[model samples]
Target: MERFFKLKEKGTDVRTEVMAGLTTFMTMAYILAVNPAILGTTGMDSGAVFTATAVASAIASFCMALFANLPFVLSAGMGLNAYFAYTVVAGMGYSWELALTAVFAEGIIFILLSLTNVREAIFNAIPATLKYGVSVGIGLFICFIGLQNAHIAVDSSTLVTIFSFNNSIKNGTFQSEGITVVLALLGILITGYLVIRGVKGNMLIGIFATWLLGIICQIAGLYVPDPDHGFYSLIPSGILSAPASLAPTFLKFDFASAFAHPLDFFSILFAFLFVDVFDTLGTLIGCASKADMLDEDGKLPEIKGALLADSIGTVVGSCLGTSTITTFVESSAGITEGGRSGLTAVVSGIFFLLALFFSPIFLAIPSFATAPALVIVGFLMIQQVVKVQWDDLLEAIPAYVAIFAMPFLYSISEGISLGIISYVILHVAAGKSKEVTPLMYVLAVLFILKYIAL
Candidate 1:
């Protein structure tokens, strides 16, 4: 036993481990809604897309547990969805099927890069701030998503009019907008309390409590969705199976339209490769930095395995009608729950697989029930804006650009574009021109071209 893996030698027992797994599961439950919503909107069968999303999550989680030996969970990523849906399809006028084809190609490219460790060279070559620029930019991008989903920012009508939905129905009567605002605000407060106060499975508890209260007040009604159509009630098979979609497609890979738009093709290629590698690496690095889990040599043995799993998951997902699968930051919430090893991931993965049996029930939970939790999460992301280097214009410009542009631009890629362009300009103007590399200059030019053309 003494010679076993670090997990056993770390003095954790089975009971303690199980609790850790449960906490990890609850903390990252936010992904259940986030990933599905993004992929489903891509015009895939909502049920089938959700099924692939969950299966990809479970497979990636299992790979992390068995191969990576770390506690991090993997799922369809936040920023990656915007790249797939908003950028590739909507922005560039590509069809969803073509986008899926492109996603598969990118995954294969990622696998090759990871295998040859080309990503490592780029990782080492880039200046730390550029990485910071990319990450901080991505944070803004993710925050924008949270806000848009919560409707904190709505498109204006008749020359950009802004208004709240003020009509919250109650017991066959209308409540004052002030009262609803206060209630939504109160819901935010309570959910924030549970998370900050360290309640066990805080997100789950917050969601359940809010929804239960809503039903009691008739603010929400419980209804079973089509059993065969939602996340939990069924895991559809046949044409919908992950292997069926991916394997055949990969074998018959398409490139007829690949070079149709060279810049767009290259930009799409660059965005996926750049965002996926750096973002995933950043997540792994951030969690490692937090958990004291880095090796004495300051390395994660699981890095290579996790990379493989993530790349495979991405290809599989596109084939199965979904978006890119990347390592999730939600795993950090699991860290707060005392999950120290892959065992936690294994249990959480099992839980997700079993989750398919109860999609109708889970889907029945009203959006408002989760609204409070989402609002709190938005605040969490918003707070990152303050951490920007306000005292120094050099850092502050890019920081503010990333933080504000995300919500304003309504696209993570655009927000990141603004951040990168600003970072490059500020760095050059600061007379520390050497700090900005040739590669960064290239990215900056690309960012500029894409946004202006858009």
Candidate 2:
């Protein structure tokens, strides 16, 4: 019984594990918006969506710690959220309520697939190149999603107009919002400086630095509200009524639409399941690989538990109105920040849960503040392009399409779809059809139907 968690035999400390969980959560701090905005386009009230994100993330993170036993944190996937908001709601014209319904159904299907072992099997069947492409694609997709959320770019006729105060704010006549932007840039600079200097806990330090700047903004009377409202910002919980009031919608299910379009709902379900499982696996394996968390047998400890918790989190989050929940890849950023073990995740989760009380604070930090981080993470995501052996179109074309399609298509699923189809087509066209594995063909067919033909 004690061997179940590796605690009794591996000699784990409960407090240390809790701290590890907390640390993992912090790396995911950006997710508070990633989920709701996607869900928000489905027509939910923004405030209500924010409140729901807080509660759902809290529940999901808790489950990740208690059940998964892996040093991973669960939040709204960045790319997934963009798809939810931009593609599902805005592009596809689905109601926010219906999108939530779709995401929930996907969660149910994921549970069934996990139970049947089909989820893992399907993942194992995918080509190694596709795996690498999808993983890298998701990172670029995240940065693109982040940038759009922060409103750093606006679409226009032909080229686009980018928002920037850089070199524009001079002579002491700066926009009020400029203050937030400067502090955010300061956060990015500090984080980069720390990384360059071999500093530990740089992410924590950066967040703290920005948080302190936020405080300074408050003291300087930047966000003073009407005195009639008593100069206090409305905590999202005050609107939702807090701890207990959250229970009603936290895991509430909406199966009405599933009955209306069973097949469509199921297709999206398969999509969600496919993306979440591999995304979680990729994130865990990536970070664990970097941290040397894998054992001599090349197996990561607590990975199965982590996956189990991740599957459970999706089920839980759907009921709470968020999209499919999964482990985040940005935990590598925390690994870069020198977090070891589950303590990292626990810290990150605790911050996410606590963030509910300060929705205004998170909201207060404007998009301009986060834009630079988006740019940085985007560059970081595309770093995998170096691994694509340009000498061979077999590797280069599909990988390039996967990397570029993310932001251009504005959908993670679509980016993956294009990448897969291109891989199969290029491999066959280049006389490498014999190398085109059957499983690749299966995925390629599905990708084509969902994204291209469908």
Candidate 3:
């Protein structure tokens, strides 16, 4: 294992890798509940989607381990699933099977792009300053996600507001929502303290400790299970269960129906391709930057393998009855936990497979428990902000745009697109057009066209 993973070379060991993997899986396991719920709205079987999510995630992570030797995990992506369910199936009046066909097509195209170095070229083309901005932007983006998951940031007239305990206080009855918010806050403090103390497996410990506290609160009747309000029992209902059959969604593609609407099918395919490319690239740049895995040229070594893993995972996921699978940003949780080798990915893949039988236990881990780890990891990632060349306005201005656009626009691809567009325009406007690469000009034009046309 050491020889294969270069554990010693990477300055990590078996125990640390194992803990990092577990931390990453725990933080990201919310996808098990979330993906099914989102895709179920399209009339697909939730059980089938759950099964596919686990199997596809495991396959992709293993691919990362074997092919790329990088500590990255892959799963059915959040926004892509939303596009699959709401935009394609519901809004466009397309069948779920047809949508799957579009995803499958996109994956095939991605594979070709990876093989031909198209994706790798794009990764290398982005300036180092923008790459740093992408890292910092993703950090803030992740922190925002953690806040939302814990309900610490609630929707309000101002767009977002902190959770309020006033209603429960006035009624003199503890509510699940208020309890979760409080526990999440406590969890953040506990996790932060553990990190400061240099606790081994601090992230994993924080998750379990927060969860144990919630279980205790539930037992004391202070926290109630309110499925309607997104709060559930902290204790597992069962130790194990049979994995759900994939028959309902397996190999369920409708290419004939999809091709009948040629224009619409092409549009859907393009959307999947464009978003998956940029999202995967942004995540790779951000997480790789966080792990110090980028080369002197701001390019990740063995990147083609990572892109191939993601592309293949998307194809396999679509065949297995899920949306496009791609490298997850949550992998930063493991990276922040000192995971620098593929052994971490291997361990994560094994846990994803284990989740099939231990769904009850894994699913019982509430979002509040894992929110702290993400928040902490986000803090770690943002330290890269100081590396940006702030004095160079030409670089600094575009980097700033990319950094803020991610969390505010809620899309990594959107942030990169706007950043590239701004970068090219700024360089050209300043008569420094020689600094912009030809590929970058093409990318900027394409992104602008994407906004206007798609």
Candidate 4:
């Protein structure tokens, strides 16, 4: 195992890798329930989605370990799945199958881009300042997701809101009334404390601790359990079960219908492709940086392999009945756990496969448990902000735009698009037009056309 994974060379051992893998899995296992919940609203079978989520995540992470030999895990992304179900299917009136077809098309495009130098060129063209910004932005984005998932930060109709502690004390929402916001707070505190004290596998310990507390609260009637509701209720039931049939959503893409309208078809395809591309780029850079895997030039080695793993995963996921498959930002938690070799990804893949049969056991872990890991990861990632040159407006403003736009707009693609466009304009206005590459101009125009299409 050491020879295969180069464990000594990477300065990590099997035990550390295994711990990192478990840490990564615990932080992201919420997707098992969350993906099915979101996609189920679009007519896909919940059982099928559950199976697809596990299978796709396993396959993608397996490829990342075997092919790319990197400590990255891939799964169906949170934001794009929402775009697929809500924006494409519900809002645009397209069929779910048609949306899958678009994902498949995007995967094909990604593969081609990876095969050529196009993908690498784009990754290299992204300035270091913007790269640092992307890292910090993704950190904030992950924290926002953690808070929202835990229901600690509630969103009003127009703006995002937070749970009221005063209200919790004085006849405000609790247990049956609220989504266990106090539990989430406790989780954050416990996990943050462990992380600050440099505890090994702090994230996993925090999650399990929080989950145990949740169960205690449920039994004590301080937290009500709702097994029949669509939401995840932290209710524990059976430990293991047979894997669900994937027949409902497997290979269900309707390419014929998706291609019926050329303009809209290509537009949707571009949306998926662009979003997947930049999302992968941002995540790869961010996680690799955390692992100290980047070279002196701030470039990821074997990046094409990593990108191809993602592209291939997306295609396989489309065939198996899910949305786009991409490297997760949550993998930062694993990197933080001393994972530097592909063995980390391999262990994570194994955990995902195991989830296929023992899903209920894994799913029983409440969002409040996992949310703390994400919050701590956000803190870890945002430290890159110190590397940015804050004195230069030409660089600072664009970097800040990239950093803040992600959480504000709720889309990594949109944030990157805005950042790239701003970067080009700022450099050009400052008589440094020569600094902007040809790829930047192309991306700026494409992003403009993309928004115009909407």
Candidate whose lDDT is highest: 3
Judge candidate 2 at residue 298 and give its lDDT: 41
For residues 219-301, what per-residue lDDT tens digits would candidate 2 score against the true structure? 67564333353233312223222332444345444567667877766665565666666566556644555455656544555
Ranking by lDDT: 3, 4, 1, 2
Residue-level lDDT for 201 in candidate 2: 47
Question: Which residue runs does candidate 3 get wrong by more than 4 Å?
Answer: none
Summarize candidate 3's per-residue lDDT along 359-421 as a digit string, tens digits: 999989999999988888889889999989999999999999999999999999999999999
Residue 265, candidate 2: Cα error in Å is: 4.7
- Candidate 1 residue-wise lDDT at 421: 81
TM-score of each prediction: 0.70, 0.74, 0.99, 0.95
Candidate 3 clashes between residue pairs 3 or more apart in a chain or in different chains: none
CA error at residue 130 for candidate 4, angstroms: 1.3
Q: By TM-score, who's the top model here?
A: 3
lDDT of the structure predicted as candidate 3: 0.93
Alpha-carbon lDDT, every model: 0.60, 0.59, 0.93, 0.86
Model 1 lDDT, residue 432, Cα: 74
